[model samples]
Target: MDMTACNVCGKIFGASSGSVCPSCRKLLNIVYDKARAYLRDHPKERVNAVDLAERIGEDERLVEILMLEGRFENRGEDAEESDDDKKRKQLLQDLQKNLASMPQKQHETGTYGSDRHGARREK
Candidate 1:
């Protein structure tokens, strides 16, 4: 079997017979066009994977795959952004970085809550 890295994420995977791996087969994630356009249109609203997925109605996993390599960055005057836009981008970046550093899930040792069966849930 053949292998290669994803064009967007750089993660290694099989390359049976295409430029893009099977994982990135969908055009939404496979191509950067939409994401680039998104970045431009929402000049003030810095989009995260979740937002993109909701807006485009694609899988969140696919959005993450397309955006894994990028974090919010202000385009500045080149994108004709207003001061508010730059501020929004910076704020979004800060929020995203904070979120990224957080653990995937809470590590709770005790009972979080109870279900209908009266059994406590633990992580």
Candidate 2:
């Protein structure tokens, strides 16, 4: 049994993981609901963690924790990746995979300058 202090209410309790205790977790769920509702109504508008916390009357840390837990995604304009960047990333990954799959040739025997297996012959 792992013991921890709740991040929300600062209560001591037995928790396997995460900082919030069961009671606070329940309360945080309610907070999540309110935040989700707010987002739904104002889908076009942008809100930072602090602003969202203020709008829902919840702690900013709780809003951040929910975002970290993937309850919601922060799709700010600055965080958006370009399609060209995505394509370039994919192309780089493909090149790396192809390079890794190719068989490696032995360059030399025990000596550094000479090639015994003809893997790299000096002209």
Candidate 3:
């Protein structure tokens, strides 16, 4: 049978429903912090899906998925949660986003943190 390495952990396993294994699949998140920061710091620039994705090293589709799934955008006003749970979720999502903007150690000049990298990245 064919096998693949999980994106999150260096584990050899069969490819499953998710892109990565279950462990790392949870980690496939969006860089909302950077996106939000950019939007705030440069509101006049008008950040959108394309520009935001380019800033990182992911496609617009992938980035969108991250944000929506990450729950960065507040959905329901009536949504209730424990203060601790809310803080933990928010922190985790933010941390994931921040890390998403960073490239792996193997990546050099054209991996992330540059809009150019997105265009140059292999499809």
Task: Output the number of the lDDT-best candidate.
Answer: 2
Question: Which TM-score value belongs to model 3?
Answer: 0.30
Model 2 over residues 5-99: C-alpha lDDT tens digits? Answer: 88777888888758888877787788888897898689887888899999999999888777777776753222343576578778999999878
Tens-place lDDT digits, model 1, residues 1-123 = 778887645678878735455656656443455555666777677677888777766667666765654423444544645688689889999999889756633554335433423653342
Which parts of model 1 are misplaced by more than 4 Å? 1-23, 26-31, 71-123
Ranking by TM-score: 2, 1, 3
What's the TM-score of every candidate structure?
0.38, 0.51, 0.30
The C-alpha RMSD in Å for every predicted model, in order, reads 16.9, 11.1, 23.1
Candidate 3 RMSD computed on C-alpha atoms after optimal superposition onto the true structure: 23.1
How far off is residue 97 in model 1, in Å? 36
Candidate 2 Cα deviation (angstroms), residue 83: 32
| lDDT of residue 90 for candidate 1 | 90
C-alpha positional error of residue 104 in candidate 1 after TM-score superposition, expressed in Å: 56
Better of 1 and 3 by TM-score: 1
For each candidate in the order shown, give its overall lDDT on alpha carbons: 0.62, 0.75, 0.59
Q: In model 3, what lDDT does residue 108 have?
A: 57
Model 3 residue 114 lDDT score: 71
Stretches > 4 Å off in candidate 3: 1-27, 70-123
